[model samples]
Target chain A: MFDIHLDFDLLEKCNRCGACYDICPSCLNIDGYDPRAVIKDILNGNAGRWLTSVHIYQCLECHHCLEICYQNYGFENAMTAMRLRAARQGIHPPQVRRGWDMFVKTSRLGEPSLAARKKLGLPEPRESGKEEFLKLLEVYRMRRHGPSPCLRER
Target chain B: MKEFAVFWGCTIQARFPFLEKSVRVVLKGMNLPFRDMDGFTCCPEKSLVNNIDHGLWLLTAARNISLVDKEAVDLVSPCTGCVSNLATAKGEILSNPRKEGEINSLLKEVGREFKGTSRLYHLVPFFHDEVGIQKIKQSIKRDFSGMRFAVHYGCHMMRPSHSLKNDDPLEPKKFDNLIRALGGESVEYSTKLMCCGQGLDRVDQHDRALQMARVKLRELKNTGVDAMALCCPSCFLQFDNNQHLMEKEGERFNVPVLYLTDLMGLAMGYTPQALGLDGHRVDTEPFLKKWKEISSRPSAAAAFSEGMKKEGSFI
Candidate 1:
């Protein structure tokens, strides 16, 4: 199983150092969207409150925080961890769920448009690694959860 | 120049084939050694896959990089997100030998291995560094001497700088350098480095996405730029498609967005139609018309010399 551990040591410093607050797009523009608050909540062991909060999903994943962070562990990590936890609880936004489902199923969010390619005189698109991807997915699921229930049903 | 595989990524192939067209046109025009390799999947976008399943995110990206390693070619992508995710995964794996081994053990079943030898590059930097500004200036047929462009260095192109160390994450200069090399002015703005907020649209926050786009578009509109040049499909979607959506709602932020390749192709003397620029949602006509008018005009020196000739030059 992939370990989803946040480095509390770095996170603790992140809480004390709000260097990225002035730079983060979400924190600056989105009201009530503060990574410092999220980090504080996470440090205090009150992260559950943010699981259903829209603020968790507000991070644009732009990595500006990572760039500006003195610790090199931007608030994005905290936001990502919160998001992962929220997703684990099946509490992420609906679109994220849909995007994830599509990605897992097709190994791509969408396929090349054949008609558009023909009209544009573009060459035929190379084959996608879907079958191998699905196999890999199954293996990953099995590794994470012994004998993936979905895999067995299939 | 080393041979490289072009990772077009999902968004460009699926939604913006025209962007793929423009990129291919410019690469071929420059005679760059880039190929479309089969058997690659999504860079498995970091936000989507990493947030949900970090392991699968790592595995998928490793598997993709392994494809390039197997080919013994470097990887270059027009999509910022693809390069960022692949490079991030490659960096993560290389730094953690145990994790790398775990990923390889998983990949061994698929008959692949992540050597992580290939260099990952976004197209803008690829052109700026590997392709070289001097070479591009020599290759182009025309220049945008009189035009001004806003260069949107999409966040992924540089940020999380430890992994994708292609450019300075905060004060990037490569895109601006490329634009200036094309004889265009890189218009400076407050939100130039701001995230396009395209990610918000992905999380069922369409209104917020629009707000984020408005932040930049309003600024660009006020700045009176000829066009907004970018290299990422997501940023293109946010500025072009979302801007179009806003226009339809009677909210006009009619800033035309151009892919870096589109601008480069135009400088290389390819017609807008040939570059499939007609496919853009926000009209590029105003920008095109202005450029044509500007290019047709004589230089100030030439105009002064002609006037001197018309009247008898002073002793």
Candidate 2:
């Protein structure tokens, strides 16, 4: 029940140039998958076809394609928007759910700690006893739950 | 004095004071003028993904943007998230005429109005593009001739919106050029192109993160690089913090992680502490020790005196 709108104008910005496919870290790193094909299918209005391809999950959302594109097309955002649309219908991969679970826990969209800091004998925030560390986690938990109750009290 | 507004987002003032220190020194040494925008809250990016209906993100970003909008100078950022958020705002206001209206409507709730015209610059693109690579090269008092480094360009700095420019994300290596200009060798490695598993680390998918780090480290290790240089703090967190866990789990790569600013600070003869290298969660000491010993030698400056050396080439 999210208020989702499809921006076809932004959608059509893709030239079907296959530039995204050519430089995709996911497609290049993996096998038997292509991102451009998904775009072609979507542009052809055959959105059903993308469900069969594993390429959707392969994207790192790294915005690599948006870099070289002449149109400055928000390829990554478009893909994400499409995925969000599809996710509503439960037509997404299991990895997406798992990824969601992880994001919810960390509140951070990246790694929780730096290994060098640990190895270099540097201290982490928790070790340093900085209150912000706990506050950050608590705030994230509360926000993730949508204002039910303060997570700190729980 | 070069006047600029200091955009200290949630991360630097709260978590990483080292970046702030290095930035202060670099600017002070160059005689740049900057004032911290106090009373600014979180850019509210944390709330955006959480689906908060509060107009906080837009409000705070606009409030800060408006504060600097008055100064009419380029907004400087140390946090990649802040840079990306502000740049995204600037781009949205410029490109999507309707978005400008929507953001303005939201901002009005907080007693602020965005005029849809402000320029925000992340430190990396600022250092590389505006600071002039040659200036960084010329400012160096120490040479990093034999060191091979993998450059980590964080996701927020990449395009879809402009502000951070001059490097292709898939083929991202301008940071490598900056490292080279400062007398270090920039190496192309696997994780050089991957997300630092940032969002996943929050979700308890430590194994998934380890796999991501392992693959990238394995690639860089095989390349025999001395360290990894990064432009984004999130990427710095992933590579520098995860390498130990990745190794404990049987993935062995002992690459040191260096911030491009920290590396540039070091090249300018700033001490290890001054560059905030010691504040890193990673054990940069071994690399710092090695670099210190290497640079301290009277013959060390002679290595890059012949000019900038390319990746895999030694003086």
How large is the i-RMS for each model, in angstroms? Answer: 1.1, 8.6
Cα lDDT of model 2 by residue, B179-295, tens digit: 778888777654566666554454344555566666677788788877888766666667777786665666667788877778777878888876676677667877777787776
Q: How many backbone clashes does candidate 1 have?
A: 0
Error of 2 at B297 (Å): 3.9
For each candidate in turn, the TM-score is 0.98, 0.70
What is the C-alpha interface RMSD of model 1? Answer: 1.1
Instruction: Name the regions of candidate 2 deviating beyond 4 angstroms.
Output: A1-4, A7-19, A27-59, A68-75, A82-154, B44-60, B134-138, B161-174, B202-204, B298-315
DockQ for candidate 2, please give it: 0.12
Candidate 1 chain B least-lDDT 10 residues: B306-315
Give me the candidate number with maximum DockQ.
1
- Summarize candidate 1's per-residue lDDT along A64-149 as a digit string, tens digits: 88888877788888888999998888887888898899998899999999999999999999999999998988877777787887
Error of 2 at A39 (Å): 6.9
